[model samples]
Target: MKKKKQEEKEGEEEGRKSMILLSERQMKEIYERAATIGAKEALKFFEAERKKEYKGRADKRLGNTKLLLRNYHMLKDHAEKSVFGRTQMEESALDILESMMSMYDNEVIIESIKRSATRTAVIVSHIETMLGLYEAYCDKSRSREIERRRYEALWDMYIAASTMSPKEIADKQHVSKDTVYADLRIAIEKITALIFGVDGLTVR
Candidate 1:
């Protein structure tokens, strides 16, 4: 009986490995297909929205950055409902999966979903799990531009202060130490505004 149980466990593990390999392969192919469809339509919409939003402010750098971020969200929503497929989970299950992002990063959530996919029989498994994984992957890749902004200000400050004392940073930037400190403060504020929007900090 002990030998039989061990053999059963080994068979299950091998089966899981096979399933994982096959599912991962399929996901890559489907992702490429989704990307092809997403690129053309997303670009067209983004361009139109950019021109519309920046009609008279072509030189407004911060305004342009905000508009691009907003347009990206629109693009992502369109893609989610279109090429990337839909969630098959219950509303509660879906909410739990999304909430997982707070505790686990995208890469962790995606791999967990992929591994989870191996448990169900091929014909009976829920496609929602795999779709969620793919959507997470797609969002991560598509948001690369927005993610870049998350570090923009910090990077600038780092560049200014990397090899210099705070005093030197002020001298190099043509400002007093107080102003250098202010510059660093403003850099953080800019990153926060870009990420979270300016409305919260705005005074009516």
Candidate 2:
């Protein structure tokens, strides 16, 4: 058993040495290949998470829509009541309508902004809202801008992940396949920036 262990250790040492002696190009190729696999896995995880989030959002939106429609019908019926009753009903209807409109506007804005934004921005914004930043920020425009920056950060992450796929990233980054791996380090820095909000990328 000891002899076998010794042989295994030697083999491992030889392998390490060979790896350590690899040319820069060879090492980069290996790193890129490994990064490609890691990026694909990360993307799959992200996509699954997004799907779950979308389903929850969709269900909530549907329920709100139903509630809005019910309120609308109730308000319409009350519109034929006595003056005081009509006024009260009208007020209630307006409240519900306002709530519905606010939700509608938010959805529209999210959709429009997301189209041009990065995934990082969307994720960060969603996280911030979930954390009750809306209450703290109290300004819709400012909140949306924060979300936009988050999206840009996410885009940068995506770009970095793409760089792992050397062949595709080579052309995209306008660099040779041999040099594309360098971008991975740059990407890591960008991701760190996004996470840390070092460049005022995060909303306060």
Candidate 3:
């Protein structure tokens, strides 16, 4: 057993010496090949992870935006009434409300609501601004005719304060229900980008 162990040790040392004797160019070639293969596999892994993460984020974003739009007037009203002395700038009102809340007891539920309301206020403001921008974008040319209709569809469906159903909006816009649904999707995507910036973009 001792002799076998000694032989194994000798073999390891010989293998190490042989490895050390490899020419620099040969080592470089081996390293390059390993790196190339490893990098490809690593890239594939990361890309898959990125795509999965993107899908999760996109779903959350779209769902939240749709919920907000469906309850736009309620959220706007809640922010206004909940925040005392509401200003023209709803976001500023929410900011003041948050500051005031921080002065009181550290109630977890109230603090959570304050934070949610603040975020909702900011998102509401972004939605309003996005609509204004879309209006201007539509005025640029007749080429934006479809975009104009899509914009109106979104407005009537959500921001008009008297929200309409998809079928109602389709009838009002003289389009198919499928077209109305498609428009709402595009509008929500635009709002997602407006609210979340580059991170809101879909992976595909």
Candidate 4:
């Protein structure tokens, strides 16, 4: 029995070692997203005692681990909100799940996210796991910029615009129908470049 427990401990440590840490920019983005989802307390937790300068990867990892382990509740809230609309599996609630074990915990959360069947869910799973890596790997500001740009260019709402007619779009945008078409083309090209970082897209 002692041998079995020793093996399990070794296995968990090995799993922790395998988890990848997120880039600093990525962590910033995660924080921003967490904030957007009303995770003020979690944000406060992350904000506390942040390293002014991570001397090296070792320094960064240790800092992140301590941050995540201590503030997992915030990540938990963020994850739950990310999948708010989806059916919580009768099998489990994401908020109640632990992320400390790495593989097993991640798999369960990922399954729950998948069952939610939304792009937001997938991103949330990635964010939550990345948070744990810091606790164990570990931005939204840029995303808001991207979204603002997309809306300005496309003149559309991801959730609501699909139901709108071109006339309605023109009316809402306060532009002529022809202008709306032209702007939409430019918008698509701009968005393509922002996402793909290629200038090859042209308005047609």
Best by TM-score: 3
lDDT of 3 by residue, 1-204 (tens): 999999999999999998789899999999999999999999999999989987877666566556556666866765564443335344552343334323433344233333656554654565677678767876685868788888888899888867789999988989999999998888778766665555666667
TM-score attained by model 1: 0.23
lDDT of 1 by residue, 128-147 (tens): 23333433443476665433
Cα displacement (angstroms), candidate 1, residue 52, comes to: 36
**Model 4, residue 105: C-alpha shift (Å):** 35
State, as a TM-score between 0 and 1, how close model 3 is to the true structure. 0.64
Cα lDDT tens digits for candidate 2, 65-183: 33322233233233334233232332232233233334545455334323322322333333334224322332354555444333333233332323134556566546576554454
TM-score of each: 0.23, 0.30, 0.64, 0.26
Q: Rank the candidates by TM-score, best first.
A: 3, 2, 4, 1
Over 1-204, each residue of candidate 4 has an lDDT whose tens digit, in order, gives 999999999999988876646678988998899778777776766655342222232232333333333334444444565544446434332332222223334444444434443432434354444333322200133455434433443434222324355567778767687776665544444433332223223322
Q: How many residue pairs clash in each candidate?
A: 0, 4, 0, 11
lDDT of 4 at 48: 55
lDDT of 1 at 87: 53
Pairs with steric clashes in candidate 2: 118-151, 120-154, 121-150, 121-151
For model 2, what is the C-alpha lDDT against the true structure?
0.43
Name the better of 1 and 4 by lDDT.
Answer: 4
